[model samples]
Target: MILIAESGSTKCDWVLLDTLNDKRINTKTKGLNPAILKKKEFKNIISDNETLSEYKKEIKKIYFFGAGCNTSKTKNNVHSVLNSFFKNSTSIVEEDTMAAVYATTSTPAVVCILGTGSNCCYYDGKSIINKSISLGYIVMDEGSGNHFGKELLKAYYNYQMPQNLRALFESKYDLSEKTVIKKLYQSKTPNKYLASFAPFVFDNKEHSFMETLINDVINLFIKNHILQYTDELKTVPLHFVGSIAFHGQNYISNQLKKQGLNAGKFIQKPIDSLIEFIKKENAVLQS
Candidate 1:
């Protein structure tokens, strides 16, 4: 058996492959970003999952691609935790961008992630060239869920959000300054907390204010992340992976066109495609 995981800062998707019977068992857990989560928390998440715990020994290999696993230090943190949990398995850890590349396209293209966080990488069909280093959600992650969340919060607090929308927002969430401050400053996963508000924006996306807001966020993302791969964009389509991209496809596509860039597929969940990609790689290796 083999286990493959695709994780963002918000959640982790797991697929257990029974190679002998050609069966797949899927399960999920909260995000396991080694950069954000403690070592004990990582162990607890896996141990608490009945499916993973039951199949721990059965899994001989684990391929974990996740956010915050870009650097060697963060990668090894996740690698060590997986090794400890799945005592019988050898784990391979890589950045989430690689999973985005595998799931989105095989040819040379620029892949971007717009989930809890945002990142862009240019894959030349051989190697991933990241032009900018992700400083995480606090300083970076433009055009992402957390980015949109921040925008909405700012608009509401500054009396910039329209009265109708502000009323709706206030009704739905506890936007007390005290509560918001505690969540942002004292929470373990502040990025995820901020991203939690993104759904409200999506829910009200048809509104004029939301339309303008979405455009601004997408424009910034294009200018900052996609444009960095200017040379690559001219030749290859720009691919996207994550919930924000999936939901905001029309807005993203329009913005890409304005920038004279081609748009590729928008994958809401990359776990299934990622598994297919891994299967092909393994088959070729065995062949």
Candidate 2:
């Protein structure tokens, strides 16, 4: 049996492939970002998942692709935790961008992730070359869920948001300064807390405010991340992976056209496609 996982800062999706039964079991768990989470937290999260715990010994191999696993330190941190839990299994840990690349294209292209956090890399058919080092959600993540959430909060507080939208936003969430401060500064998972506000923006996207907001964020992402691969964009398509990119495809497409760049694909969840990609690779190896 094999376990494949694709994780963001907010959530992790797992698929257990049972070759003998020719079946797949899907499960969900909270994000396990080695950069943000403690070693004990990783063990706790996996142990708390009934499905993962029950099938731990049966899982011979584990492929984990997630945010914050880019560096050797972070990758080894996650690898150690997984090996401790899945005693019989050997784990392969990699950055989330690898999963995005595999799921979107085998050919050379600029792949971007716009989920709880944002990142971009140029996959040159065989290797991932990241020009910009992501400083994480605080200093970076231009057009991600957390970025949008931060913008919304600023607009609401500065009285820049439309009156009607302000009313709706206030009614939907606790906008009190105390609560906001506590969540942003006091909470362990501040990135996830900020991303929670992104659903409201997506839900009310029909509004003019949302349209402008989306365009602004997408433009920043293109300018900062996509444009870094300016030379490559002339030949290769820019592929996006994650929920924010999935929801903002139209805006992204329009923005790309204005820059004279090509838009390839928008994948909301990469786990399914990543699973198929791995299967094909295994088949080719065996053949």
Candidate 3:
């Protein structure tokens, strides 16, 4: 049996695949970014997950690709937790963007992530040749859900938002400045809290201001992250993954086309693709 996981700042999807019977089980848990959570907390999160507990001992290998597994220290933290959780299983920690690469295509391409956080990379078919240093939500989650949500909140609080939209936001969320501040500073998962507002933005995308906002956000992402790759990378297709990309596909596609770029695929979640990649790779190993 093997377990594969894709994790973002907000949540994680875990797939348990029993090779013998070809049985599969899907499970979800709150995000476990090693960069954000401590080892004990990470262990607790896994232990509390009912699905993990059910097959902890049975799992022979775990392929974990996550948001904060970029650095060695972060990877070690997650590795320690997984090791402790499933003593009989071996764990491999990897970056979330790499998961996007595997999910999108096997050939060389530029892969971008625009979910609760943002990142991009140059994948040369077999390996990642280049990538940006994603500075997390607070500093540089540009074009992500958190970025859109933060912009919306700022505009609303500053009275720059249209009265109708402001009224709609007030009526729908009933969130005061005090509540927002408390959640941001005191809450554990502030990124998730901020990203929760993305749905409202997408729903109002037809609005003039919304179109401008989305365009600006997407443009900034392309300029700052994806454009940094080598000139050779520009020749390949550009693939995207995450909620923001999937939701704003049309807008993103238009922006890319305007810039003479080709849009490849946009996946809201990469679990299915990850599952397929893992299955194929494991099958090859066995053969």
Q: TM-scores of all models?
A: 0.98, 0.98, 0.97
Model 1 regions lying over 4 Å from their true place:
none
* Per-residue alpha-carbon lDDT of candidate 3 for residues 1-287, written as tens digits (9 for 90 to 100): 89998999899999999988999999999888888898998889889988899889999999999999989999988888898889999999999989999999998899989999988888888888655566789899899999998998988888888998888988878588789999999998899988999889999999988899899999998888877864855578889999999999999999888777778899999999999999999999999
Ranking by TM-score: 1, 2, 3
Model 1, span 200-219: residue lDDT tens: 98899999999999999999
The lDDT for every candidate, in the order shown, is 0.93, 0.93, 0.90
159-214 per-residue lDDT for model 2 (tens digits): 99999999999999999999999999999999999999999998999999999999
10 residues in a row with least lDDT, candidate 3:
226-235
User: For residue 147, what is the lDDT in candidate 1?
Assistant: 96
Query: C-alpha displacement of 87 in model 3, angstroms?
Result: 1.4
Error of 2 at 136 (Å): 1.0
Segments of candidate 3 deviating more than 4 angstroms:
none
Residue 134 of model 2 has an lDDT of 92
